[model samples]
Target: MEIQLVGITVLWLFLYGYLIVASVDFGAGFFAYYGKITKQDHIINKLISRYLSPVWEVTNVFFVFFFVGIVGFFPDTAYYFGTALLVPGSISLVLLAIRGSFYAFNNYGAKDNNIYMFLYGATGLLIPASLSTALTISEGGFIEKRGDKLVFLAKELFTNPYSWSVVILAIVSVLFISASFLTYYADRAEDQKALELLRGFALFWSLPTILASFLVFVTLRQHNFIHFENIIVRYWWMFVLSLFCFIIASFLIWMRRNYGTAFIFVLFQFFFAFFGYGASHLPYLLYPYVTIYSGYTNETMGIALVIAFILGLLLLIPSIILLMRLFLFDADYVKGKK
Candidate 1:
């Protein structure tokens, strides 16, 4: 395979890491706030807190890697996406800052402030929704080149069915993914109340997750027929595998068995769907405006960056595994004894 393909594949892996880790973190925040407002904080918030304590700080590492890697490997994306993404990117950054600050305040300072909790929960949903615009715009039609200036069609983005579908999918997927993992975590900790509550959430969101995924497909067909056709003709098997994983994961959750294994299926579900989407959208970083061949960095730089990022992923994965072993899954730690 070409170096550019290897580069984007590695970067996609980084983004996929963010999709799982940050989903759990962000979903936990929303669930924490939900528990407080529903007067069930005593039942589930502790479990949420335990998960968040050691995890939130590392949630953005994957995102940072993807962001920098994309720019490093595909320098032209900065030129095309830089102008188009200014508004949405700024909003995502602001929400991220707000989410982090409020998380700190709610956890360490006020401990139960409604305002802080609301910000935490709201940002959890909003950040992903906002960040998803890049993918939406990538399908093309939302950015216009006007005399060397790429104008992002904010109105078109807001009005497009495909864009909203992606946003809805992002939000629901986060909740479903988060709930599935939390259910597994609750079971591991033997917190029956938390387990039951989170299991309910996991089941409740499953239908919406699948439904929203199909909704995106339908809208993508209408929005970008060529890419949609590519997916149907060439990438159908990947999506089929994704659907299979979803079914298996949902079934395991429903049966209340092997919660850890169920969460692994959840990861596979997204793994296939997410990578398939990226794979099908390949060669074009931003439809019509940029292609891998056009936007890629110098061969020397690309080779060096690819090796560096591969090493980074190698280091990052074990670090997370060690973190999980030491804190997240530790017997005393999960039980809050630590």
Candidate 2:
């Protein structure tokens, strides 16, 4: 029974995982393009601007297809997957990776600096990897029968060729770090005011990521409590950590004078919280009553959800496209208006 249940979990996990990745890619592209324009970089900025509309269009289409897949073909899947829930979760992971990568490659690598590069790289990679791994493992493929002890799926992913990909990702991440840091710090000595503002902005943008770290840690602890025995002080520590994260986020927002940083922080925090909320009640995709596989197999509701999903995609796509266009071409017009 456990094995069968695990198999179903894995299937749903793959779906969620893919959704998360897609959302993250879309979000990162949005943020990156917007950030470049704000920094007044014309070369790469122009290039991203041109492509923004198309990217948004693609994202919208993808979501529509995803929604259709969920609702039309697998109405029962809704009980496990939920509407657009995994989108934010996956996107958050991608944004983290992009942030780390931007810091490593752009900030640290260009100057041949390694410490900041490593710090950001590790933070970015480890957190996303851990989440992805946990999700994958919970789905059931990596559980090995080793004398009643379950070896996690993450351990397996790390051992496989995927580990090599991580090394490459590390390198790319460092490059992005170096680029971003160099750009920010290049004129810092010449422009003290700008530097000060930038620092404040950095802190503001970081609030969500900081809070996310806490949320992820608490989540892991919760999972351990459910699956394993003898884990101590799980709920108590989670509450403490959550409070700390909230305080830090509030403080950063309060201190921020720049709207850009504050906006990014708020947006990221929303997604982070959304994902965190969804994940908190996992192993039971449908709360209170239906488990992932047990009670979610009704065909009629599945078709309705699929239609809803498709409609959602149609709406989301155009909005994303318009947003990209605004960022790429009309960002200057919108900057202070908001």
**Best-matching candidate per lDDT:** 1
Span of ten consecutive residues with least summed lDDT in model 1 = 103-112
Native-to-model Cα distance after best TM-score fit, residue 289 in candidate 1, in Å? 1.1
Candidate 2 C-alpha lDDT tens digits along 167-228: 34323322222222322332222334433443443454444444444444454444434422
Q: Distance (Å) between predicted and true CA of 240, model 1? A: 0.4
Per-residue lDDT tens digits for candidate 1, residues 1-338, read: 99989999999999999999999998998999999999999999998999998889999999999999999999889988897799999999999999999988877888789999989999999999999999998999988988977787889999999999999999999999999999999998999999999999999999999999999999999999989999999999999999999999999999999999999999999999999999999878999889999999999999999999999999999999999999999999998889
Best by TM-score: 1
lDDT of 2 at 132: 44
Candidate 2's C-alpha runs over 4 A off are 1-141, 145-154, 163-296, 331-338
Find the 10 residues in a row with the least total lDDT in model 2: 174-183
lDDT of each: 0.94, 0.40
What would the TM-score be for candidate 1 when compared with the true structure?
Answer: 0.99
* Candidate 1: residue 149 lDDT (0-100): 76
Model 2 scores a C-alpha lDDT of: 0.40
Error of 1 at 69 (Å): 0.5
